[model samples]
Target: MTNFKITLYTDPVCAWCFIGHRTLDQAITLYQRTYPGGRHDMFEFIYHPFYLRNTKPEEGRMTLEDAMLAKNGTEAKVLAIKTKMQRIGTAHGILFNYDSKVGSTKLAHVLIQQAGRHRGAEVQKEMVGAMYSMHFEQGGNINNLDELVAVAVKVGVSEQDAHAWLRDDQVGAEVDELARTAREELGVTSVPTIEIGGLRLEGAEDVGGIMEALVSVKEKEIAVGGAQDPF
Candidate 1:
């Protein structure tokens, strides 16, 4: 009956984060099946925003190819990266479409925060997944307000509420501050940084690694009389 919180710092547009998300789910399922009395409800997942690209909404969206070319300095390198991503992503049950748009994830992060505050952690997690799918699968623009609101509606948030929250300067500011804290204070420079029971797994760790980490944390908690402080 012990409760554990798993905090994930991720950006919606990160290809590795998308893979890590699915890998984490597989690891959790493996843990529950392998360990006696391991219930899904015992773990709570909380997602925080970590910006990979800080493009503002006013800057508009850039095609994924253009962004990659700008970063890698050549089309060949970009294609190689995309091909590698597709290979790895296919293994993880994610189909990555590099024809998507890339832009600021601030609104998407704000939506996730609002989901957690209003709907609970599960909904918040669902919203994050939805956002990832929107960008990586559907090739939608994450920075577009209308697209963000549509995602919110799909995740059980009212259209009116989604519009209101995205327009709120205070809420947007809070999301920005959270990203700042994750980067500056927490030393998280990468996306898909997952923390469980004070142990961290950076980047897109494979399913086996994540499962081992989960087991290690659970065993440690049991050994210490379940008194370990939360992360």
Candidate 2:
């Protein structure tokens, strides 16, 4: 029932998702400030969960540095990535620690799926931030139930309920739905793919391109009177 909806498909352990998240938050905040109720009934953010590492499970856990090196990215390349991410993160008031352990993002993404339903879209944002910070900053284990519960509780989810749900797997189907929709339906094989009102963003950190695309989409909507239902 919303006119302007942004679907941000991402993984938990992705450094770029965290980066993109910070950028999107800034852009959205700026959007609201500039156009007040321009987003009236006007906006909804659907967080779509997709794992960037699931394609190679046997690959095991790999840090960003290791992943970079394995992919033939040199020390200079790694430093460049680190610098860019840190600069942007600092600008967005986010402190990112690049050396954090990168674990399986599935459970964390699953927690986000559960949070989307149990909590609302707005609260889901907080849940996402907490989980990302845990992995990227505190270096917590996303695969651990206790750690996940702790993250959820830090973001105001009930500690007891979070623990209970860890065993329940109540939202496993919803998590799978996010993955399937992104891959099969939307043809997204990458992380941080954001689709807003039919506007597509393959990489969240691609700032200039995404901003231009977003403005163009907004103008197109205005030209057509307004956004229509995707349902």
Candidate 3:
């Protein structure tokens, strides 16, 4: 049996990262059902909060509309992409309300890190999912500490602990360091960059493609293991 670690670098505010989350969930489920037994325990997916905006919450942030405009994309282009996302999401039963104002993910990353530390990875994943749902599904601002703390509580994180982590300068610095490491070391300038067993799948990826990548990595691990002679 081989253990595979999948590090998902994502921002809660990214619409496609939300889609990537759903796709990854589906791919994992499909892989388990298709291979059964060993495959289920072989893969472990961990979420790493990536600040795509590279802005601190204390720093004033741009709205979603303004950000797109700054990228030189017209409203029509944005609408077209949203329409496509809606169509694909509907097919997968995932609804994305992109109605919330966009801002930095600094606070959200802090909450995620706290959850992982105090709770566990499973709890952290739930918190991450809730953060995404609040922003993308319910049209809530994840950058708002109140809104974020509510989501954290919903995921079983104590409100007191949540607030403490959010207000702590060390925690905020830790989150910043994570973003720095992802940028400087991992070369991750984009959201939804998934590294599965050292093989990265960046941007939006389809379920089938992600599953194929996972299988390929597993096969490589097996081959490498088989080549070694144990006395």
lDDT of 1 by residue, 21-40 (tens): 99999998987777666653
Q: What overall lDDT goes with each candidate model? A: 0.85, 0.72, 0.78
Structure candidate 1, residue pairs in collision: none
Residues 1-231, candidate 3, lDDT per residue (tens digit)? 657788999888787898888888888888766743434445666777677775656653455556666665688887777789789878666687656767778888888888888888888889888887888778787678889999988988788988998887898888788888998998998989999878899987999989898677767866878322122
lDDT by residue (1-231, candidate 2, tens digit) is 135678888888787788888777766656544542434435678888886765432233566567666665688887887788778777766676655556566667777877777888877889898888887777565566677899889888898878766555657666767788888987998978888768777776545565565566676876777754232
TM-score of model number 1:
0.94
Q: Sorted on lDDT, highest at the top, how do the candidates line up?
A: 1, 3, 2
Better of 2 and 3 by TM-score: 3
| Candidate 3 ranges beyond 4 A from true positions | 56-66, 225-231
How many residue pairs clash in all the candidates, one count each? 0, 0, 0
For lDDT, the strongest prediction is 1
Report clash pairs, candidate 2.
none
Q: Between candidates 1 and 2, name the one with more favorable lDDT.
A: 1
Candidate 2 lDDT (Cα, whole model)?
A: 0.72
Arrange candidates by TM-score, descending.
Answer: 1, 3, 2
Candidate 2, residue 174: lDDT = 68
